[model samples]
Target: MHRDLHAVTFDCWGTLIYEPKREQGALARREIFRKCLQQHGVEVTEERASDALREVWLRHWREWQAGISSDATDMAGWGLEAFGIHERAAVERLGCELAEASLEQEVRALDGARETLEQLARREIRRALICDTGYSPGRVVRQLLQREGLLEFLEVLIFSNEAGVPKPNPRIFQAALDPLGVGPEQALHVGDLRRSDIAGAHGMGMRSVRIRWQNDDTSDLPDAHAVVDSHAQLRELLHLDGS
Candidate 1:
């Protein structure tokens, strides 16, 4: 159980916020392919390109996950086989292909992140963001937080791409805490991913809370100090009233 929380750190995607689209299985492949081709001066319709991209993505998805290791780069070694595109320049161009996807304006605050943050801001607890890297850079992540009005309340926002280390590797977690001037035990991390956020936090002696919205698996979450269904519960975890 959590005794007291000095700071509340969070994961970005699928936790506090989400990509706009619902991640259509084949459609993701098609979108990637369409962008890859466009980057190479090839013009193709979305429908035609997606058919091939779907097959490529399917193959890569199976391969990538089948042999995934604790230290493997999440997106490495799947580019050429999965999308028939491996050029670094092309990959950069395809990064924002799904940029249009984001939570609707109404549900932008995942399960009470806004409310929880507001409550925490009034209390003594500090707040920070330790998020995984996606197609966008850390600046974009900060922009999203700002758009949601979360930036003003946070002490730091650590992104893997910016820090050059992924989570579950104590360094990234340390980077988040470095700016706060607090030790591990004083911080409480909240995220949806068990492997990266929860496990990583516990590894470093910080408390952890697992958010179960997209991830329903509780089998591997024994180390988490608490389980919250939404970001709103973050306030309660910090022992704050609605205020």
Candidate 2:
């Protein structure tokens, strides 16, 4: 066992997986909402639904900037409520449906994602995921991991939606330490976003690695223990000489 580190925490979207065809995924969600509204006898144009979704996203963006996080399902409900729909169960179901639509190839595991996870498993190191989810809720994100065979190695799942606070906030990252039975010094965090992942883990006293993936612009980068381009580098950095 690597005595210097007890656990590895990762960010979900950009770090471990890439959700391609983002436009198509957005369209799938919009269509779901469009149909849902039609069923509720409030038929509207696609642009109208898009407007409502955009507004809701803005609200969440503000909350996130303030170090507050809310679930995608909750945001979905709020967006629907703005259009005069009040069925709580129905709203939640629709919200989930929107997220479910993105679980295909459009949302796929990033390169080296599997290799890194397997190496971690082989080494018997604890693993966890911390993400700020707004477009996809925790349930759907978990399903994506399950589908790709990555969920088994992860011992903990922390989402801003469920955590009630997003990244750059020490509270959210602090929540993972207790479950993993590891202190800040014993944990390493890997993520793509400098503002959230690196800063949040650093704030909580964990060594942080920022993965600079393709098309991921990283200028004026935040301070982290290291900056890597791929999961392979991360494994190497942690001294996991690939078998």
Candidate 3:
């Protein structure tokens, strides 16, 4: 049951990086939305802005579960609509600001993430990222990766916002594989979510490894082919430890 892995794909939010200040980022975004609304002469309380942001996130979650992708712009529009703010300029500014809000807060890569990716790169094993981005889009996530020195190690970056489809959808997986010229059988996807990452890669005929170093997803979905708690274990599993 040993298959050659030519390329390795990864999930962003939980597998590689942990958003320790996620709430702070959310609050920043909420404040950005509130100020944007005020500039448009549509005043709303912080509580109401927070509620709109929460509703938009809930909608995004629902869409993601159904394999649909919603980007920052989409969420921005939804947020404006929630408060009956139809100003085109406000939507544009809000989207731009909200997309960049996460940059204000720091994001940390899980232990061994950078080392694992660097080792994979040294071995010429192609790497790609298949991220299901939330309010922050692929551009922001790429910046975060670059800050952690992990972005250069990846060859292809496929974000659901850009692909128009999220993980658990075969198309997203194919999008990552097509650029690498690596088939599903020759690739291994590592992620934390059982529903999206595990199910998506498995359904695409790729081997999957679940990493629970950050968030341990206990969803009632199919389990991955292999499960590791950290990238050190992942290296051992992938025979990268000189075993």
On lDDT, the candidate that comes out on top is 3
User: How far off is residue 124 in model 2, in Å?
Assistant: 2.7
State the weakest 10-residue window (summed lDDT) of model 2: 214-223
Identify the candidate with maximal TM-score: 3
Q: What is the per-residue lDDT of model 1 for residues 1-243, given as tens digits with 9 covering 90 to 100? A: 446567778887777776444455236545655666666677777766755544544653454234222111223224433545567655544544433222222225565677777777788677788876643447666777788777788888887667776677788889889888889989888888777788889999998888887665556545577888866565566667645
Q: Model 2 over residues 1-243: C-alpha lDDT tens digits?
A: 144888899999888877677778777777888898888898889999888878888998888888877765777788889988889887888877876777743677888888888888788788899988877778888989888778888889998878888897887788877799999989999888888888888888888888887546465757677878887787788878657
RMSD (CA, Å), candidate 2 to true, equals 2.4
What 10-residue stretch in candidate 3 is worst by lDDT?
Answer: 1-10
Native-to-model Cα distance after best TM-score fit, residue 161 in candidate 1, in Å? 0.8
Q: Estimate each model's TM-score.
A: 0.75, 0.89, 0.95
TM-score, candidate number 1:
0.75
The lDDT of model 1 is: 0.65
lDDT string for model 3 (1-243, tens) is 124779999999888887887789888998898888887778888888899899999999999888789888888999988768877777777888988888888899889999889888878889999999887899999999999888989899999989989989999999999999989999999999999999999999999999988788887888999999999999888877552
Error of 3 at 180 (Å): 1.2
Order of the predicted models by lDDT, top scorer first: 3, 2, 1
Question: What's the lDDT for residue 184 in model 3?
Answer: 93
Off by over 4 Å in 1: 1-4, 24-32, 35-91, 96-107, 219-221
